[model samples]
Target: MPSPCSSPRLLRHGPIFFAAFLSFFVSLGTLPAKAVEPDEVLQDQALEARARHISEGLRCLVCQNQSIEDSAAPLAKDLRLLVRERLKAGDTDQQIEDFVVARYGEFVLLKPRFEPHTLILWFATPVVFIVALLIVVLAYRRRSAAAQLPPLSKAEERRLKRLLEDR
Candidate 1:
C-alpha cells in the first residue's frame, strides 16, 4: 500500500515547487534591507552618528512600530535625511527630536516624551501589569486557601470511612 505522504501531485510538481521556493527567497535577498541609501549618509562621522542616534528613536510613520532607522518606508527615508540635514545645520539631537515631535506629535517617537498628554501612555502599561499581577496573586491565594481543608472531626472521619466501606 502507498503511504498518503507519497502523493502523485507532489511528485509531478516537485521541480516547480523547489524552483518557486528558491526564487521567493532570492527575490527577498535582492530587496534593499535598510532605509538609508548611500547618498543619504553624512560626510561628517560625528554628525552621521548623531543622525543615526536620533533616527533610532523616531518611529516610522508608515511602518508604525519600527524605528525610522530600521524601517524601509519612504517616510522613514525622508525622516532619516531630515535628521542628517538638521545635524548639518548645527541642531542638537534634542532640538531635532523636538522639531519632529512638534510636526508629527508624540506618536513619531519610539519612546514618547512624558508630557501632560502622554503621561497616561508612559504609565499605563506598568500600572495595568501591577494590577493584573495583584489580581493573579489574590486569586491564587484564594484557591489555595479554599483547597486547604480544616481538620475533620473524629465522628466525620468515622462516617466517611463507613461510607467508603459500604461502596
Candidate 2:
C-alpha cells in the first residue's frame, strides 16, 4: 500500500513541481543583473567584462543577500556606478577590490581576505570540535574507570539496602 505521502497526485505533481522549481532556480541563480547604464559603459569590452566579474564578487550591503550586480537598491546602484567609473579610469581589479574592502571593512568581499584576523573564522570549527571531543573523551574515561572500580563495601551496601527498605 502507498503511504499518504506517496499518493498518485503527489507523486506526479510533486516530481513535476520539483523539477520545474529546480530548473527555474538554477536558471535564475546567476543573478538577474541589470546592464550598466549606457553612460557608464567603457568603450572597451574587456573593461566591461572585468567590471561584471568584480561586481559579482562584491555584496550589496543594502540588499543583504544579493551582489551589487544583482541588487536594485540605491546603495547597490551607487556601488555599481562607482565600480564602472573606477574600471574606466584604468584601475586594476585588485586595486578596485582593495579600495572597496578598505571602505567596507573585510565583510564586503564575497570571498573573505585571508589574513591573521580571518584565520579565526576558518579555524573556529576545528578548535571547538577538538575541545568538545577532549571533554567527551575525558567524561567517557571517568565513567569507564568509575564502572571498573571494586564494588562498594558490604557494610555500605547493607546501609543502602536499609535506606531503600525504609523509603
Candidate 3:
C-alpha cells in the first residue's frame, strides 16, 4: 500500500494546505486581542468610544510594551474604567489625559509629551547616531591617510634595497 505521504491527492493539495495554515496564524497575529469585558462597556456609545481611544494611547504599566486596550492586566482594566469615569464626568480628552498623566506620571503615556524633562529621551537616539557617524567618518579618513605612505626618503629606499638583496 502507498504511504499517505506518497498519495497523489496529498501531493497535489500539500501546498494549498500549507498556505491555509500559514494564513491562519498570520491573521491571528494581526487581530488585536481585546481585554474589555461586557460589564465594563458603557451604555453611552460616545463615551465608550472616547474611553477606547484613550485606552489605546495609554500603556499598561504591567505589560510595558502593550496598550491598556490590548492588555488583560488588572491595572489595564482599572485604567479603562478610569478613562470612562472621567469622560462621564464631562472631562475633555485632554483633561482626562492630564489627569491620568498626573496620577501615573509621563510613563503611562505611549507617546510622551515634548517637555523639558523628555527632551533627552526624544533627542538621544539622533544625537548618538550623528556622533557615531562622525566617528566612522573620522576613522575612515585616518585609515585612508595612513594607507598612503609618504614618498620614501632616499636613505630609506637604499636601506630597503639592501634588505631586499639580503632576502
- Highest lDDT against the true fold, candidate: 3
For model 1, state the Cα shift of residue 49 in Å: 0.1
Any runs in candidate 1 off by more than 4 Å, and if so which? 1-33, 151-167
- Model 1 per-residue lDDT at 125: 95
Q: Scored by CA lDDT, what does every candidate get?
A: 0.89, 0.85, 0.94
Candidate 2 minimal-lDDT segment of 10 residues: 31-40
Model 2 per-residue lDDT tens digits across residues 1-167 = 88988898888789788999999989897757674567766678998889989998999898767788877788887888888888878899999998998898778887777799889888888999999999999999999999998888999999999999999
- Cα lDDT tens digits, model 1, 2-109, are 876588988889899999999999999976456778999998888888888899899999989788998988889999988988888899999999999999988899
Instruction: Tell me which of candidates 1 and 2 scores higher on TM-score.
Output: 1
**Which segments of model 3 are wrong by more than 4 Å?**
1-27, 150-167
Q: Pick the candidate with the highest TM-score.
A: 3
Task: Assess every candidate by TM-score.
Answer: 0.70, 0.59, 0.71
- Clashing residue pair totals per candidate (backbone < 3 A): 0, 0, 0
